[model samples]
Structure formats: structure tokens, C-alpha cells
Target: MPLIKNVIHRFHVKRPLTARERELRLDIRKPAGDAPHYQLSLIRLNSTFVECVDKWYAERGFGAMFGAAAFSAVAFGMWVLVTNIFKHWHPIGLFFLLVFPVLLAVTAYIFLCDAFTYTHYPIRFNRKNRQVYAFRPDGTVLKAPWDRVYWTILGHANPLGWLNVAGHVMDESGKTVLETFALSVNSTSKQGEVKLRNHFEFFRLYMQEGPAVALQRIQPVPLIMLPPIDRQKESWAFGWERITLTLNGSPLLQILAQVFFLPESLFRWIVMRTSKIPQWPQWVEDECRIEPDDPWRREPGYRDEEAIAAMQATAGARRNG
Candidate 1:
């Protein structure tokens, strides 16, 4: 059976946002003078950390789950190699070959362990304040302030030297870090080595927070998969629906798509047809959903004059407020 597109539930109707609402949305209001209006939907909020984690993992498709399994398998292989080294299981002259394998195995195990631990912990995104707060699965808040966060930001492939990930931050000196890391932005570009230089330069601009210019862009984090056509029409999984979004600026929305395993309408048919894997009943087929025309992936090419003005006005209001 085919999977489907999810429909988004709108949090607020079409209306001018009040000052307080604008603060909460972290979006600027529409400027005057014939500017078009761009609508942004507030997807999910007010959920506990555990709830967010459950939702994130439960909706990922079979491929991601398989990927994790593959990692575990690699870890097991490493364990076997380590055991072989200690037990002298390899041929007497092959000990040197065993050295590399042993190290590789240890590395794989450590990586897999970290992945599991990261997933088990709950990560929460604050839509209003634009901050991510991660908690242990047991609900203990991790100890760290924004300025002192010692987390690693993953790097991505880049071409033409443009940074792929983007966001804004204010440093301790009150200077805003506008553009940081260009390698991520140029990830999809074909410029190759030259683009990496661009990325580094962009990073320099934001690293010092000299004068803020929104540079860190949020890229699509999914392992890329297309949904089956028929499922696109289903309603139960409204999270997959197509919606218009503004892309040109920084701090791209952290979109969480709930790819469907099967539309209820088709699941029955699947169950009746086959059972190849003995434990397949408990399995669901879905992927980490990516929003179409995601700002980080590509430009929307939207040059709406009205919407731009509105956005600028909103930005001005935010700065003044």
C-alpha cells in the first residue's frame, strides 16, 4: 500500500498577530504598502520532552530503523574482533591485520553507543524562544546554559563554499552572530572546493558576533525517502500535508514529518497478503519526514513584495520590542 501526505493543523487563523503573539512566534509582522502576507503555522508545542522523543522515533520509517540495526551489527562485528585479538583467534602472522580491525570495532561500538544514548534522551524545541532543550529520558534537565552549551554541531557536505546550517545568536559582548558556517549552505551547490572557502568565511562572520546577519541555516535532517502516491491523499496522517513556507532567512523551522507506515485503509490489505518476517507485526514502515521545498534544501524563489515588507516590519518590531 502507498503512504500519504500529512495535513497540518493550523494553530491560529489568518489575522494580524498582536505584539505579544509576534514575540511568541519569533516572526516579524507584515510591513505596510501593498506587501503580500505569508502565513506560518505553529505546529506542535507545550509537549513534554518524553512526548517529543516518542513522537520523533515512532514515526521514523523502516529504512532508518534498519540503519540503526546495521550500526548495531557493525558494533557486534567490532566486539568479535576485540575478542579475537585477546583470544589469539587470528592466524599467528595475521596479528597486524587484527590490529586495524580491533580499533575499527572499538570505534564502531563507541559510536553506536552514543547514537543509542542520544536517541533515548528527549529533545525539546522551544518555538517561541527558538532554543533547543534536551533532557534525559528519565526527565532530568541537562545542566547547561545557552552561552556554555558544549554540544557538537554536525557538519555536512558543501559545494561553492556556502554554509548549509544557519541560525542567529547574541554573544556575551552584545554583538549578534548573524552568519556562521557556510559549508552547510552550499551543500547542495555544485561548486565543490571553492564553496568550502565561502563556508569558512561565513563562519568567521558569525563566530565573533560582530554584526548579526542571519547566516546559520537549518538543513533537512532526514535520510531522504519519497512517499507512495496513493497514501498522499490520506487524512489520519495530516502531518505530511503540503504547506507554503517562507525560506529565505535564517533559523529555518525545525520540521518533524510523521511519515506513515500504512494508511489504515491499506494496512488491512498488507496484513492479509503476507508475513515474511516473523516479528513484522510490531514493525511500522515510515521515515523521518522532510518538508517539501525546505528552506535549507532549496530556495522557494518566492519574491512576494507584500510578504517581504510584512516580514521586514515584523523584524523591525521584534528589534524594537
Candidate 2:
């Protein structure tokens, strides 16, 4: 049983990063210089392709467990209703009975689908060159002009205010060239909010005021609030085809697709485990690299002395007035 558990653990869990990998890995907190170029630290184990594969498998297993638990809970509840109240079926119970299955099935299908489809390509921003590059897992690269990129924040206002910073590059006709998943930030506390605002301000300044203007320490513009209508439109624009087909199409077909795709996803997972990930090109390495020590790097809510003084003065004035 110990041996079996060890094997299962190896298959399902990612190994921790080596000392050398940790030393060399980019830290997103310390953006290189005060310039408009920055790269978000890779999610999970990104040092090697093998580690990434392990992380993927682990994620899939956890996802499956969660989905199963949800489905089973719903199913059991419905079963109890059917057995106990067969003659006096309540409308709410009947509604749940009908809706829960579809919801669970759809949820399961999405959960499984993500296990295969989710890809985390490294993204870099270069305000100087007016370019954005995404290094794909397959050794290919996607590049887009800065002007063509559109960015928005997807966040909820709560005690632990979490934000997802997402963007996409589009052509003149508004066709998407490349899109990035949210680089999540926790903004629940005052410090977290400052960090989130700083990062957002960096991008906003570069885009609106240009690199030269951004170089100067100007006050940050308030983060824009995306309306529900706009958020819905963005969602539709991002993955409308897949979403529409999955929701509107035959349930039978959905189940069949899930069944068939399982093997393929498993095969890919196996391949990723066995094969080595290619090393990034020298150009990409240089472009995306983060420096260890940058003057601009600071703890959340702690600005440089000059900025701190200015902020304090402003707050004092507001209180006095």
C-alpha cells in the first residue's frame, strides 16, 4: 500500500524546484528597472517541461475529484427526493432534479475539457519596442504590436479582492491574434491593493502616457470598471463558439465527446511526462529575464521616500481641509 501510494503520488504531484532553478527563475515582484517591460512569474513549476506536466496531471486529478463530489452530492439529493416523495413531487425538487443533471454534466464536460486544453505560454511586455510576445510550448512564438492589444481587469469587490488581469491582441477588423489568461493578484488588504494598483498603473501609464511619460513618476490613473454588458461581450468574443455549441448542442454528443477525449488528454499527459521541454531561445531568454535587484521594487504600500512624502502631504491636506 505504501509503494502504491508513492507511485500514485509521483504520477499526480509535481516535484519541488531545485535550488538552481529557484535562483535563476524570474520574480514578478521585482520588475526589471523602472521601464515598461515586465513578465509575470510562471504559474506552478515552470523550470522544466516535465515539472509542468506533473503539475498539469495533479491539477486534473484535483479537478476530477471536485467535479465527482459535486455531481454525487446533487445526484444523491435528487435520489432521496425521488424515493421519499415519489407521489408528492414538489416543484422545486422537480426543478432541481431536471436542472442538476444538465448542470453537472456541463460542469464535468468543462472541467475535463480544461484539463486538456489549458496551456500556459510565457508572456512578456516590451513598451519600448511596442511588442508583446508569447512563447508557446511547441517552440513557436506569437508576437503582436502593442497598439493592437486590449486589456481589462476581471475582479470581484470583496474582503479578499481578487483580480484577474487579462488582455488580447486584435487586428484592425477586431480579429484576435493572441489572448492571455488572467495574471491573478490578491487585493484584499491595503498592501495587496497598492501592489495591484501599481502593476495596473504601470501598464496604463505606458499605454496612455507612453514610455517616456511613464518613466517619470506620475500619479496612477484609477483602474477602469468594466460594466457587466462589456464583460459579457468580452466573454462572447473570447470563446463564444465553443461555449454556444456546448450549451445549445445535444447532451448525448457532449457526453460522447467527453468519453472520446479522455484518452487523448491522457496520452498527451503521458507524452509530456516522458519528453523534455525545449529550451527557450536566447532572444526570448534575454527579453523575458528579470533582474534580481531593481530600485523600483518595493513592498506593498511602501513607496520610495519621495513618493511617500508626497502621498503623506496630500493625505494631511485632505484631513486638514
Candidate 3:
């Protein structure tokens, strides 16, 4: 098989080590005369479908809690206004009756969107069949038959299900490797570790022909978000053909539900009502923003203007002394 010219090499990004460092890292040895047996492929293990589902539900809870609080405050304000208008009648009771239903509806919608569908899955290439598979957390496989596959898109980095869900079928075969957001590697918590292990096992069992003993040279792609969360436009990788799955309905629906707040709310109500204890808190303070203060620069990336000024002043004083 002809290798692509743009092969991603780990050494390219990693700092080159001296003889001793190389030995320390991997016991330095001369390259074998023969070419490496299998082509190396990178598989990033983030969160499993189950974890993502849980996280989505947790977020829905927060949203509903926040929304409920806001709505209740507003309703109270309205009640006060109506009381002033009709001092003896107590019209505030009627106001509560009207407003409670609307608040309930909003909360219900949030639950549906958060619970019903799949999002954040790891996509794998099956070299033997030359197809793709979206590995779900439950061990159910979404297989992309060769005939259905469109060309695989290379590099877009939003972890949420944007173009991540669309499956383009091949024009000639009429088959598509259709999968929506199923697995994600974004969360690095304990749950995330379990999900990564699941994917690693899946790839080990399934990816027979690709690469060496273990997948290597994995790097984290920076996270991006679906629209309405950011001013940036929504993104996707479009396959040339329509997706084919045993399951009916557009995978795009899953993408929409996971990315935006309103659709997510509706998705949760439909999918999560009967379920108990869906998911737990996902947002850790450390991950919310990049850290700036550090030994390296007194700021992340060594680029704080104030820190630079302070350092310059200290250096000048030291020189005078």
C-alpha cells in the first residue's frame, strides 16, 4: 500500500533527545532494515457514549435549576404587580397558575434534549474492510459498510457532534458509514479514564491490520463548540453520500440536540423522564479556563505583560547591585 506523503510523525512534534535521553525514553536501538510491519494510526480515547449521556443530563439539570429559579423570581415579581392592581381580589394566585405551567414546560424540554440521543463517540477506521465504525459505550457497533462510505474528512476539532454525525454514502456503492456523535475523549476525569480504556480495547480487538502493537503518537485536538455557545459558525464534515444505518432518522438530529441548549432540553425530556440519576457534575474549575500563572512565565505561555515588566525591573535592580 502506498503511504500518504503527509504521514504524521511523533518525532516531528516532540523535542529531540540526546543519546542518553533516547535510551531513557525507549532504549535506543538502530532502525531495523525492514520497514515497520503495520502503518501507525492514532486513536484518541475521550469519553464513552454513556458518560457523555450522563454529562448532558447533568447539564440539563443545572440549566433547569437555573431556569426555574429565574422563572420563579419573575413570577413573584409579576404577582406583586398584580396585587397592586387588585388589592382585594388576590389576582396573584391566578398569575402563579399561568406562570407555573410555562416554567414546567421549559424544564420538561430541557430534560428531553439531554437524555434521548447519542453524542461524543470515537470514530475508527477498519483497514481490512476499508470502512469506519462508531464505537458506542454499550459495545454495540455501528458499522459503516464499504459501499455506503463516502471519503473520510481529515481535520476539524469540535468535540461535540457537528459534522461529526453526518455520513456521506459513496456514489458507486450506495452504502455509507453512518454514525453520529457516539464517543468523546474530551473529559479527563475518572469516568473519562474508563471510556478511554473501552475504546483502547475496542481498537485492539477490531483494528487488526493497522499499525504496531499499540496505537501511538496520539495528541489532543483543541476543543471547539457547536454554535449558539459561541459566535462562531457551526461546523461539520460532509460525506458525499447519505448515511446508511440500521437505525432510521437523520443522525443530524443527534448533533443538533447535543450542541444547542433548546434542542438539548427537548431531547432530554423525551429520553430521560423515566431514568433515575442520569449523570454527575462534569465542569471542573481547572478545565474551565487556561492557567496563566506558572514557574515558566509567571503566566501561561510565558506571556503576561505585567509579569514581563516586573521581571525586567527585578533584572535591572540585580544588575545595579
Candidate 4:
């Protein structure tokens, strides 16, 4: 479903990033406003690592299961055609017929895989070690030092590239990309690219500087919606939260949507029953372990401005006491 991540997997950086590539690389040392999409992807935030969702727009569709079924049907058709009708066709036709079943089956498997996998892939920005860990779609993880990874605003398809915040991890000697991951940002213009830049800059600054310094100029962070590990913990298989989130957290709109998207909600309920949850390896988890008195502790973006202010006041008072 996500073209960028798939495109990046096949890519290998042959040379060092040049000046033009660095044009969109805003100074992490400098501050900028944020795109709200960044906050939506946040899963966990702390001094050690800030885990956020990857492929930001991947979760909205309810038709992937259907797509898989469709591809399976096509594969079945090809299988029947090859075995019954086209056994004595031209070499090329026979080749296509023979190859198509496998190709379509592979495509169907891909769809089923995506449908049955985790609700979203997670990317962890390790503030403590200055590393980045991205959960790849193929059940692998992308690891790189935040500094060694070349960060840039990759505008795909001119002004049509909705998501553009991408980071490419390069090998030593500053050549050959090992892996890549896109940050959460949607863009349609130069201004939107700037917004995407700001979203990435927030992470860069947070990693280089601190959350306190990095969050200073950004927008109010959105409440994170993490995938539920236990089915019992989910409300309508997490559809209630998502439906509510559809209209900017409006209660009335959410109610209307529940009524409107009842079928989809039910489908999601069934689909989520089999959804996978990503788990980091022990070594990485060990590295990200928080000390008992880690002074860099910060709260997730789960409140509004006034509520955040009140929370800060309470925290300050507790610290003072």
C-alpha cells in the first residue's frame, strides 16, 4: 500500500549526499513549526527512544482483505485456464499462463500479509544512543545511527507527493544506503514540504537536543493511537477510537460516523482479531532501558494546551516538593 517504503527497500545510495539533496535538509539546530500528522504516529515517548508509527496513512482502508480475495480469484482463474484451456498454446502464451498463477498468487499473498499484519509499523528514534530503528514490512527491522542516516524532504511525484519526510541510512564512506524510512508528513506544496520538514526537524532536534527544546516551537502534539495487543482491550477493535479521530475528535461527528460506517467498523473488528503487534529485540530493548531516575522523562502528547500547562504545573510542584 505504501509506495515510498517499498521503493526505498530496492534503493542503494552509491555516493555521498550532495548540496542539492541537502537543500530541503533544514537545520535541526534551528526551530520550526510542526505538521500535526507527526503526533498521530507517536506510540511511545521517553528519554531513551521515541517510537512512532510508520506509513502514516496506511490504516484507513477496509478493502485490503477484499483486494486479497480478488487477487486470489484471479490466481485461481489463471490456474484453471492453464491446466484446462491453454496447455497447448504458444510458448509465450504458455509461459505467461504458467507464470501468471504464481505471480497472482504472490500478489494475493502480499495483500493477505499486509491485511493480517500489524495495524501499523513502528519506527523508534533512540534519543539515548542517537539511533533509528524502523520495523520493515517484511518482518525485518532497519537500524542506523541517526547522524549517519541522510535525512531529506523526498518529494515524490512533484506536488502530488503527500508524504515526503524520508531518511536514508547509508554505509561507511558515506556511500550505499542500507535502508530507509519515511517520517510522518503529508505535503502538496512547497509550504507543505516546509511543514514536512518541520515534522522531521522536530525529531532531529529532539534527538540532538532534548524533547524540552525540540517541542518548544512545534504544534500541540496529537494523542497517540497505539495498536492493541490484547483484543479485549480494544473498543470495536479500535474502530471507535479511529472513528472518533476521523473528524478531529468531535463526539457528534464520531457518533455520526459510527452510524455511517457500521459495516466497516464490524469488518475492522474482525480484521483486528488477527492483527500482529511488533516487538523489538531484547538487545535493542535493553539498550533503551530507562533508569529509575532518568531526569529526561517527558509525557506523551495526550492533552491540550491548558491541560498540558496544568500537567506541567503539577509536575513542577511535585519536583519542588
Best by lDDT: 4
Off by over 4 Å in 3: 1-100, 115-142, 151-214, 219-321
Candidate 4 lDDT over residue span 149-229, tens digit each: 777666553554554677877777655555667775455666566667667766877788776665554534423335533
Q: How would you encode candidate 2's per-residue C-alpha lDDT over 58-160 as one tens digit per residue?
A: 1223344455557777778767877866787677877777887787775555344333332323444554455666554344665676565544443444675
Each prediction's TM-score versus the true structure: 0.26, 0.37, 0.30, 0.66
Q: Is candidate 1 or candidate 3 better by lDDT?
A: 3
Give the TM-score comparing model 4 with the true structure, all chains together: 0.66
- Flag clash pairs in model 2: none
Candidate 4 regions exceeding 4 Å error are 1-20, 32-37, 56-66, 72-107, 157-162, 188-191, 219-271, 294-321
In model 1, where do residues sit more than 4 Å from their true spots? 1-43, 46-92, 110-115, 118-171, 174-321
Better of 2 and 4 by lDDT: 4
Q: Between the candidate structures 3 and 4, which one is better when assessed by lDDT?
A: 4
Task: Give lDDT for model 3.
Answer: 0.32
Q: How many collisions between residues are there in candidate 3?
A: 34
Q: How far in Å is the alpha carbon of 246 misplaced in model 3?
A: 33
Number of clashing residue pairs, candidate 2:
0
Higher lDDT: candidate 2 or 3? Answer: 2
Global lDDT of model 2? 0.41
Clashing pairs in 4: 13-177, 162-187
Best by TM-score: 4
TM-score of 1: 0.26
What is candidate 3's lDDT per residue for 1-321, written digit by digit as tens?
Answer: 111111110011122223432222211122211212111112222211101121121233334335445556666766675666555565666776577667656544543332332332234444444455543434344456533433221123345422111223323333322223322222324333333333333333324423332223221111111212111111221100111111125677644444353443443343334223211123321222322442211111122355456667887999999
